[model samples]
Target: MGSNVDNALFFLVSTLFKLAIWVLILRVALQLVRADFFNPVSQLVWRLTQPVVGPLSGIVPRYRQWDLAGVLVLYVLAVLYIYAVFAILDYRVGLLPALWLGLLSLITMTLMLLTFSIFVQAILSWLGPGVNNRAGSVLWSLNEPLLSRIRRIVPMVSGIDLSPLVAILLLQVFYYLVPLHPVLR
Candidate 1:
């Protein structure tokens, strides 16, 4: 019973942290993609994240197009999540190991976000070729630079763009092949 209760609590906490991390990521992506600032969704994302990011912005500072503050916050949240998971599993993590895992988690999250954006762009291409919403625009902006490069190499076949397929394949390969275990071990 105790084990079950612990597991349930772990799941709840982990889910909540993941949701917060996802929001932070979306906020960063929106900025990176230059999403329409006046859009309702964009405004909501900014408002939701501004509390944490607004202060951190002064300390971490932005580097050109990258939101270093937002990225640093994500890393801190990832580290906290890792520690929480370890505690729930009855294991204790050292600071160095926790930092390493946190860095790995951030990388994994960024790659997953990229893949998701590409996936959304591919879906939008099929559903509505002319769709022009904030989300759609953000996804396209995020994916276009990568997709265009892939397209240059892969080329379209039968008038269908295969760049997204190739881009996703490469991203997936990197995601799976990344040596995450070595860092943890």
Candidate 2:
């Protein structure tokens, strides 16, 4: 009975820790993508995230209306939290390896989200102009820089946009080819 109780407690703690890290990651990603920060939902996310991000803001500088400092804070917290969890489980691993994995996972997930956003926008555009969809706007904003670069390299063929295709392919490469870390391999 005592062993079962201990196991339950450990599970609860680990689950909570993971939940916190996921929330932090989502907050950072939303900020990076410049979601509607003024809305009530965003305000709630910010309030929940500020506990971790506020302190790190001092060390990392903000960039171009984006809260990069907050994102860095989320990354650091995720690495530390994973390390702690591994330690609790008595797993032997180096911190750097875990950090790299965490960061890569974060990046891969971010790119996937961005790619999905672009695809969604492309579909909406097909429906008609002035869709006034918030998600479409967010996708357009996030993808504009990448699409612009691709445009410079590859001129639009027959007035068809190819940037989204290129972006999706690049994201796929990162998702599949990149090792989480050299040492982890």
Candidate 3:
């Protein structure tokens, strides 16, 4: 295939694969955070990933709340995606390096999701005191755990709640400090 065509195809495939991975990530994170499993968004994530995770769950096993099956699936997908990137670039990477970077990529993506959710939640709140929706509920469920902790130390200034900003700042700092996006480069 021509370089341009190859790159385009790779982008399309990677995007779809990444979307699936994000859904799995959501499932794992939601379980870990003890989010309402019956929530529509939660159910959607579960139903979407059930086919793949169901089979792996038999072998990989779930440790308490952590979904190891989903995690294993994520790792395999990431490793394969990393390998594809290396191939497209006409370069080679060891399995260990690829594995390490693949895990980092997962963390990087999770951090991105949290950061983005925080922004959206903040926007929704600004729109009104009670902007209830399925998406907002899911975002709140995922982020409230972290944001509440920040709220304890950082008091609201006047009428403005800075918890979201404070939380994002901390998350961003951790995100950068962890070298989370190594595979991305």
TM per candidate: 0.87, 0.64, 0.89
Model 2: how far residue 7 lies from native, Å: 16
Error of 1 at 50 (Å): 0.6
Better of 2 and 3 by lDDT: 3
Q: Which ranges of candidate 1 are over 4 A from the true structure?
A: 181-185
Query: What would the per-residue lDDT of candidate 3 be over residues 1-185, giving only the tens digit for each residue?
Result: 46898879777767876787788888888888888888898999999999988998889878998999988887888788778777876778998989997888777778878898899899989887786888788888899999999989999899899999998888788789766445363
* Worst window of 10 by summed lDDT in candidate 2: 176-185
Q: Which segments of model 3 are wrong by more than 4 Å?
A: 1-3, 180-185
Evaluated at residue 110, the lDDT of candidate 2 is 60
RMSD of each: 2.8, 5.6, 2.2
How do all the candidates rank in terms of TM-score, highest first?
3, 1, 2
Candidate 1, clashing residue pairs?
A: none
Model 2, span 1-185: residue lDDT tens: 13876567667765675567656655766676677777555567689989778887888888876677777776776576557655666676686778776777566556656667678777887887767766566557557777888878877889887887887887778766766543222
Give the least accurate 10-residue stretch of model 3, judged by summed lDDT: 176-185
lDDT value for candidate 1?
Answer: 0.81
Worst 10 residues of 1 by lDDT: 176-185
Residue runs of model 2 more than 4 Å from their true location after superposition: 1-48, 58-68, 84-90, 181-185
Candidate 1 on 133-165: residue-level lDDT in tens?
777776776678789898889978999999989
